[model samples]
Structures are given as structure tokens and as C-alpha cells.
Target chain A: MGWISDFLLLNDPTLRVVVPGVLLLCGMSAAVGCFTFLRKKSLIGDAVSHSVLPGICIAFILNGEKNIFYFLLGAMISGLASVLIIDYLTKSRFARNDTAIALMLSVFFGLGIVLLTYIQHQGNASQAGLDSFLFGKAASLNKDDLMIFGISSLLIFLLIAFLLRGFSLVSFDDSFAMSIGFPVVWLKSLLSVLTVWSIATGIQAVGVVLMAALLIAPALAARMWTNSIIKMLLLAGIFGMLSGYSGAFVSYALPQMPTGPWIVVMASVIAFGSLLLAPRKGLFSQIIERNNNEKKILQENILKIFYHIDEKSGETQKAVLQEDLLNQRSFSNRNMRKGLRILERKNYLSNHLGAWSLTSSGRVEAKRIVRLHRLWELYLQEYLHLDPDHVHDDAEAMEHVITPEIEAQLDVLLGNPTIDPHQTQIPSKDE
Target chain B: MNSNDLWIVFTAIAVALICALPGCFLVLRRMAMVGDAISHAVLPGIVIAYLLSGSRNTMYILPGAAAAGMLVTVLIEWLQKRLRVQSDASIGLVYTLLFAIGVILVTAFTAQTDLDQECVLYGEIAYVPFDMMSIVDGGFSAPRQLWIASGLLTVLIIVITLGYRGLYLSTFDPGYATAIGISVVFWHYILMSMVSLAAVVSFESVGAVLVVALLTGPPAIASLFAKRLPLMLLLACVFGVLACVFGYLIASFLNASISGSIAVVIGVLYAFSLVIKKIFF
Candidate 1:
């Protein structure tokens, strides 16, 4: 390993040549991957990659085996053609986008297979290197291949920077961007070409079949953690680079291990990690928030009963049986104890001889919750045209959730109604 | 050309008919890619059978190819469901990988044989007739690819025709079919296996790419002019025969590879059909 590093540094097998070269190419790829992810067009890469097979084969037939330049050019043309055909067909009536991509991917790749078979039949030794292009053999890549990748990565970075705003605007809202004088159609065509270029650049290292994952995985992973376009782009690039390096390292660690699928696996791990743990949008945060909300609601439920009993008879001193309240709720006695503790802490209700009653502060909180609930029910029934039965269930949930501004607004809008639709009293301010 | 020349066309027609029978269903199910996938995947199966038998026995290779085809179907389906990746991505991933593996193994193991990847692609259907079958005292018999293909096509046509209503109902709207109590997955597997078997038989003659074209193009061409299922299937057979016969003759006259030219011509024909339908209709 040390000797290899020494060689790459001194134009031998040293770290200087290998590490920096890999870093530059991997960094640019991950950056382009960010845009691809935000656009949600992963499979476009799949269509383009599979489409390159015949191109390389045709190049060999026409130019003989030695010309990497012509072969790569041919590969790029056919790869772009696959993308165009997919876009053209999917935009039409009969076929869907996914299905169109799948069809073209198979057909062109099949054609490439047939041609490669012919090349193999002739017993040319050059055909030996062709299969490596399927899953990508980054280690087999030489200084010549590295130069092509370096130039392509630079071109991609420059092009993206030049059109950053235009891409973002068009990606988010094509119609709005068009109205504002952007060439939405032309810009989109440019993006499509970029996708093909991305596919072509990665083909030598990642190979055809697995290059789609590189285009898709980093972008997908980036989306999990951000809303800001710049942040998303940056994060996506980071994920892409890390996945590339890690996939490269893993392949190095295990001899003969394919780079493309492993890179994809690494990207997927990034995506899944963000999916479970990213702030605000993370699944765990959402679940915890929801659980806390439900706990708070259960505590409020006990205070509500006391307010209800006093409302019917204007008898504030009645001691309602805890057993009776338990029957009315779906919560078990264990849950009720927790609720009672929360209620007692707030001085909402006190337990006396196993009976529950609300204190004065509790009565005010209960009346307000009930008022907000009925207001929402009225709002839904009036504005949204919901069924009264549906309104009750919805309002029951919304009642405790309205803010002070919403409560005031509803009060003014409803003309301070004394009774709800069910002939029950709709409590007001100062009640 | 004599009456014997008719056998060449007749045997081709028989092989084409068998391929087209399940092709109609494949096109309808949108499993046309699977037809191509299984066709290429059959390389390993044929290679394995050849290894064990030391002979290219139709008895051995038929099941071998079909088994390999089904394995691909199972692999793609399993990967798609288990990985939560999109179906198209999974299909593309599985087939290319399996095909590549098959290609590598072929070159590595049977390097001595003339069975290169290109022969596997277009297949030597023109050469199918020469493979020595059981020679009789009375008369000469056809190579069994024709007979086996004919039988498979017949069984496929019968199965599809019998279950036509159920198949159509599910294909048209599986959600609606399920709502009406049809077991979609049961009918689905039947179509998968039928298409797999058909593609396997056709692979040795037409090769893989043409399998996709035959499966998709004829039905697509028929769909342009015909509305009924029976009409579509029948016209597709006519279109299939036309593609095979005309495709072969044109390729032979040009001295081009039969399967590549046939597939390209089918693409051209499909495009032409669309153009004509557009301009006239």
C-alpha cells in the first residue's frame, strides 16, 4: 500500500496521482448528482447507461479496438439518443415514462449485447475489457481515462454554476418560470443533455448497468435533509462524494467486488439514515411529537368532563365518579391516573373520594377548549360544507388546538353565538 | 425455389407463430422486456445444458432455457419487491447483471466452442434446420425447434384463448378486476411463465432483441387497426409472419445478420405503421 502511494505521488502508483484524481472526479460527480436527485429523475440515467453498449461495440466494428476516443464518442451519442427516445415516447399517449425507459433500456442494451457477441465471436482480445463497462471497474481506469473524466467533471461544474438559478426556478415551477420569460422548454432540454453527459462520464468507471444508481442515489439521499435549494445541492454533493469514495474503498477492500452497486448501497444508506433521523422531517421526531400531543390531549380530557357537568345544571360543585368518566373514554384506568396527575399539576381538577371535579382555573380552560371546538365545527359546516356528523368528530379534535387569534377571529365571524347547532351552549369569553 | 423452400418459410412461420402466441400476452402485460431478458438469460442455461449433456439436445436446452428464464423473472420480481426500488430499475438491474454473468461464464467456460455472444444474440435460425435430428428410412424430419415451437405456441394460444376474458379483464384494469373478485396474481404468474417459455423457444431461432420486437411491435401494429382481442392476436400473427418472412428475405438478400436486420426492420415497420395511421386516420 505504501509503495503504491509512493508510485501515485511520483507518477508511479502514489497517492498524489490516485487520491487527488479520484477526489476531483468523485467530488464533481456527487455535485451533479445533487441536481439529479432534486429533479427526481434517477431512471433517466438507467436509460442512458444501458444505451451505451452498442455505441462502444459499433465503434470497435468501424474503427477497430484501439481507438478509445471514437468509441467513447459513439457511446455518448447513443446514450443521449436513448434519453431523447425515452422522453419522446413517454410524452406521447400510449406508454408511461417508467415503462418507456424500461423498454428502451432493455432494447438498446439487447442490441449492444448482440453486437458485443459478434465482436467476441471474432476472437478479438480487445472485447475482453468491454464487460467491465457494465458494472464499472474504476481500478482498471488509467491516466488517459482519468483525463477525460477530469475534463468532463469540470465542464459539468461550470455549466451547473452558470445556470444554477435557471435550473432551480424551472425545476420547482416550470409554468411560473415560463411566464417570467425563462425558456422553460430549452432549459429542460439542456438538463436532459446534462443527464446523458452524467451517464456517459461515469460509464468507464461505474459501467452501464449500475451508473443509474450513481445518478440517482446521492440526489435522493440529499433530499431527505433539506428544503433550501443551495443546501440541498451541497448536501447531495457531499453524499455523492462519500458514497463514491466508500464504494471505491469497499471494492478495493474486497477484490473483484463491483463498484457501482456498492456505491449505490452507500448512497442508499445515506438516504435511509436521513429518512429516519433528519431534523423536523425525520420519522422519529414526527412520532415523538405525535406521542407527546396525544399525552397532552388525554390530560385535558378529564378537565373537560368537569366543565361539561357544571354547564348542564350550572352546578359547579358536583363530584363526578372517576368510574363514570372512565366509561365515557377509551383510555384505561392506568392512562387516567397519568391524566389526573397532569390535571392536578395545573390545578385543573382535584380527586376527592375517588370522584373528579374541576377547580376554577380548570373550569376556564375547559370552557375555552369547548368553545374553540364548536367554533371549528360551525366553520366546517358553513364553509367547507361538511356533514354535521363529520364536523363533530373534526371539531372535537380542533377545539383544543385553535390559537387566541383564531378564537377571536371565529368569535367575530360567528357573531358571538350563544348556542351551537346541537342546542348545546357555546361558551363565550368571560364565561 | 421449390416446395421445399416452402418448408423453410413454413418452419419459420411455425417458429414465428409459437413466438407470437405468447407475444400478444407479453405486449399486453407490458412484460415485453422480460421476453428480451429471459432470451439473453437463456445463454447460461444453454451453456450449462451443453456442459452436462455434451450435446445440444433439444430435450435438455428447452427446459434449461425456460428454467433460466423463470429464474430471471423470479430474481427481478424478488429484487423489486424486497429492495423497494422501482420495478423498471429492478428489471434493468437484474437482466443486465444476469446477462453479463451469462456472457462472462460463456466466454470463460466454453471458449473452445464457436458459441460467442453474437450467436447467442441473433441466434442461427437459418442454421436450425441443419442440426441433425433422428433420420428415418422413409423421409427426413424437421429440426425439433420447429415442432417444439409449434406445440408450445398451440398450448399458449389455447390457454390464452380459454382464459381470454379473465386475462383481458385483468389487463385492462387489474384494480377493477380485483374489485370484481379476480385473483390478479394467479393470472399474472400464468402469463409470466407462458411468456418465459415462449421467449426461451424463440431465443435459439430469433434471438433476444427480436423477441422484444415480435412481442411488442406486431401487437402494437395490430392495435392501431384492430380493436378486438382476437383480431389483435390474429393480425399480430400475420404481422409476425410478415416480419419474419420479409425480414428474413430482406436480410438474406442484403447478406445482413438475420435477427438484427429483422429487429431493425420491425422497428422501421412499427414506425411506418404509426406514420401511416397518423397521416390517414
Candidate 2:
């Protein structure tokens, strides 16, 4: 409790400076990241981040002192240059976009490394902290740096709020935006500028290499929770701030831990967490949904097999042995037994000794499935002009999926057909 | 040049040749960023291997890092194919996460050891000449990195030579290759494994960034000039060697980082290749 209050109350001066600065940087980058992500230029953010290294080095050389403003100015310039170079290379047919991006990223970072080593050898006292940009020095950010971050983040937020529609339009459908007489090119440039600015400001916290993660992970995590662009932006910002706060807290508590990687690790944990546990789009939910769907299909398929067996024997509600059911359709013995027990529990089937027969409710349900299957086969044969043999496999898949409304529409479309293309009697709803 | 210079350049050339071979296939497949991802993802493997072995032995570290590289490839594939995540985002997410964990591990556990974050990002290639290993009771001595790099180069050359046709067919016309009973997925993973091996081996000498530069840079320049696969492979090796020589010279002249200078040289050569294409071709 003491530690929690100490942290939340900002008792430490370093925490007071680091916390707001990191939160602003992460939140803004995450918001801007959604645009780059929607534009399918996520890797471009990576290229831009790597490209800023040389600019920082060059800025240090020119300014002869570590001024955050000049460092950011140089970073934005080089970052934008890298983006333009990638765009040109992609457009020039010289290389594919990925190739161009990879090339630009390595070349710029390499140049930065060269310059960084060059400055290192020069033995300037102020150059001592420049290497910090490589991995970041978030714990060392001063009050001036926080003010810069606060101003830059506020500026980015306002620009995004004002041009939200245009940015989204360009991101989702640039050509459509162009067709509708929007300033597509300007909007794209504005978005890139915003991305570069956010990245330049944020890299001081997370460093150049992992800055792309800060940009991409929060947006990706937030995307799992919402569909609207505005909601995605807001949620991404929140996720970014949460990760930033936690990363700062952990690093502060444990003095030896580096702040940047921890921040990235926290953001990734949140992103992967959302990926696994989000309600609709998460992997866990998706797997569960798929399992349920497969179960429903399997149940419907088992019901259809029972109807087929009854039709073959020219009897209704005849008790069939387990072996007899297995002979009709090759299901795993385990799945067959489990499916049989489930059907019995639902009152769709009744088991007497080892033999099973469909109940009245089960008969009606089974008849509807067979009707849908034959009706689809007839519809495909008549309307699609598919071969009669090909129609059976097609209907087998559609029977489990066609809903009642679609079934009625298919009935009217097929015009009350009693016989399928295979000349089998099609069961009607009345029967 | 002195023996020290000769050893450094030779070691760099070995690293370059090994990277360029698999890199050509990566460039052909348009998976340059995957190469980048593998390079960064090998970090944790190197750290964990160092911790387990209690030494910076290449024997232990190479397999660990190579396995880490393969994990990145598999994770990216799973994310894209299974979860329907976008390709670039998956690559970004997986590598950065692995790299972050790697960085944290390096800072936390390996603080007392020689393995530092600086070496992981941009390695100390200049010190390669000093880390000597004497075989046969001090009868013969050479840099251990040179030995490992040369051995890996030989293995890579043999593998690439033997599997050229399969790689060629699968890379150029994967659909047709699959139709003709070539397992595209099999060849894809095999190529990814080769890339992992190359990246891990080169990582010790040139670090991760320069590893990416060597992997994608030479092949990219080679493809601009050569029309055929064999020619492209040969040209990529040639360009990689040239970049090593020139980069070493420049680094020595400026007293800068050898790997960094090599990357810059590669960038220069690529620009020159583009200019020649523009003017003459």
C-alpha cells in the first residue's frame, strides 16, 4: 500500500517527469499508428523510426549540444525523407515495397551507426548521452523534455481531431477520397508528418528499434475491441497510456531495468492478451466460436445420416444399432457415441438397449434438413446448370448452413419441387 | 594489409557470403522484412544460450539463436495464416516482442558477462582478431569467429548447391511447383531455416542491423543486374565481398565501426547499381 501510494502520488521527482512524458508519447503514437496501420503502411512506420537515427546524430553534430527541439527537427526531416524514398522506390519499379522498405531501413540505420561511431570517436562530452537514443533513456527525461512531449502530443491530438474524417478516408480508401475531390495527397502527407512527429517524440522513451512496436502494438490491440475508427483511436491511446504507466512503474521499482524494452514488453503483453481474449475477434473466442460451429454442423450431419438410414430401410422411427449407424457414415467411434448421447439428451433420439431411433421432434428436425439438402441439390441442378453428380457434394455443405428464411426462398425459387435432380423424393415441410 | 586486417576482412567476407546466398532467395520471395525480423528475433536465443552454456561459445549460441530465428518465422506464419493478422503487423509484433524480451534478459541476467546490448545491436567486429582459439595444443591458432563463419559458409554452400533446383522451382513458380508435387510449404520452411542459420552465424560478427543490411542489400543490388538465378547468386556474393573490402578500408581510415561502414558501403553500391541501370540499361 505504501509503494502504491508512493507511485500514484508521484512522490519521486523522476517519476513525475517520466510518467506524464511517457504516457503522452505512447498515447499519441498509438493514435497516429491506427492511421498508418489502416493504410497498410505499418512497416513504413518501422522504416521511418530507423531512419531517424542519423538525423539525431547529425543534429547533435550541428547543434554541439543536446537540444530536444533540434533533435526532433532533424529526426522528422530524416524520417520524412526515408518515407519519401520508400514511396519513390516502390513507385519506381526498382523493388517491391517490402524490399524498398527493408533496404531503406537498413541503409538509414547503418548510416546512423556510422555517424554515431564517428561522433563517438570525436570525444565530445555532450555526445555521451547520444547513444541513449539507440535504446532510449526514458528514466532520465527532464522537465524540459516533458514540456516538449506535452506540447507535441497536444498538437498531434488536435490535428488528428480536426482532420479525423480526411485521415480515415485516405487510410481506408484513398482513391475514393481522391474521386470525391478530397485533398488526398495532402491528407496522406499530413498523416505521414503526424506519424514521423509522434515517432520522433516517442523514440526518446522506447528508442528507435522498438518504437515501431509502440506504434503498432497498441493500435493492433485496440483494433480487436472495436470497429469504428474513432473508437479504435481512443482505445489505442488508452492502451498506450496504460502500458506506458505500467512500464514506468516497473522500471522505477526495479532500478536496474531498462525502461524502453519494458514498455514495449508491456504493450506486447496487452496486444497479445487482447489477441487471445477479446470478445469477438480474439483467438480464444474465435476458436470457441469455430468449435461451436463445428459441433452444430456435426449434429446436423448426424441427424441427416439418421434420416438417410430410415429412408433406405423404408421405415420411419425404426431402431438402428450403433454398428448400423457407423456403416452409413464413417465417424470415429468416440465421436459417434458422444453425438448419440447428446441427441438422446436433447430428446431428438431415444436409445433402447444398443439400438437408437429418432423421436417425433427429431423426425421433424431430420426431415427439414433432408428437405433443405434435396431442394438445394434441385436448385443447383436447375438454376446453376451444375451436373447432377456434382450437385450432391454441393448440397451436403449448404444443408447445414441454409437458414429457415433462405430455405423458404429456395422453396419458392424451386417452385414446390417434390423430386430432386437425382430423382429422389424431396420431403415437404407439411410432411 | 597486416594479418589482423586480413583476418577481419576474411571473417566479414565469410559472413557476407553466407548471408547473400539465403538472402537472394529471400529477396526473390519478396520477404526482405522477414529477413529483418529473423535478425532481430535471434537476440533472446543468443542471450539464453550464453546463460545456459556459461560462455560465449559459438557452438552453443548458434543453435540457440538459429532456433529463435525459426520461432519468429513460425510465429509470424501462424499469426498471418491462422489468426488472419496482417502480414506486416505480425512481423512487427513478433520480432519486437522477442527483441524486447531479449533486451530485458540481456540487461537483467547478462550484465556481468561480456554480452551487452551494444554488442547485440552493433557488434565489435574490430575485436574479432583478438579472440583467438588455438587448436591442437597451441600448434595452430586462428580467430574462433573466422573458423565458425568459414565452417557455416561451407555448409551453406553445400546445401544451397544441392537444393538449388528445388529452391528455384519453388521460388519462381510456387503454384506450379505445388501442382507438380513439390511441397511448397516444405521448401518455404527449409528456406526460412537456412535464413535463420545465416542470420545467427553472421550476428556474432556484424550484429543484427548489419546482418539485415548484408542479407537484403547484396541480393537487392544483384537482382538489378543479373537476369538468371545462378548469375544473381554469384553477383550477390561478389557484391558482398566488395562491400566487405571497401567497408573495411573506410572503417580503418575513419576509425569507425567496421560493420556500420560495411552497411554504408552496401548502400552506396546499391545506389551505384541503380544509377548504372538508369544510365546504361
Candidate with the greatest lDDT versus the true structure: 2
Judge candidate 2 at residue B12 and give its lDDT. 95
The digit string of per-residue lDDT tens for model 1 on A15-95 reads: 333444445555665666565545656556666877888888888888877466887788888988888777777676445
Segments of candidate 2 deviating more than 4 angstroms? A309-316
Give the lDDT of residue B92 in candidate 2.
94
* DockQ (0 to 1) for model 2: 0.83
Error of 1 at A151 (Å): 1.6
Which consecutive 10 residues in model 2 chain A have the weakest lDDT in total? Answer: A293-302
What clash pairs does model 2 have? none
DockQ of candidate 1 compared with the true complex? 0.13
What are the RMSD figures for all models against the true structure? Answer: 6.9, 1.8
Worst 10 residues of 1 chain A by lDDT: A7-16
Cα-based lDDT at residue A282, candidate 1: 63
Candidate 2 chain B worst ten-residue window by lDDT? B110-119
For every candidate, give the share of true A-B contacts it also has: 0.06, 0.78
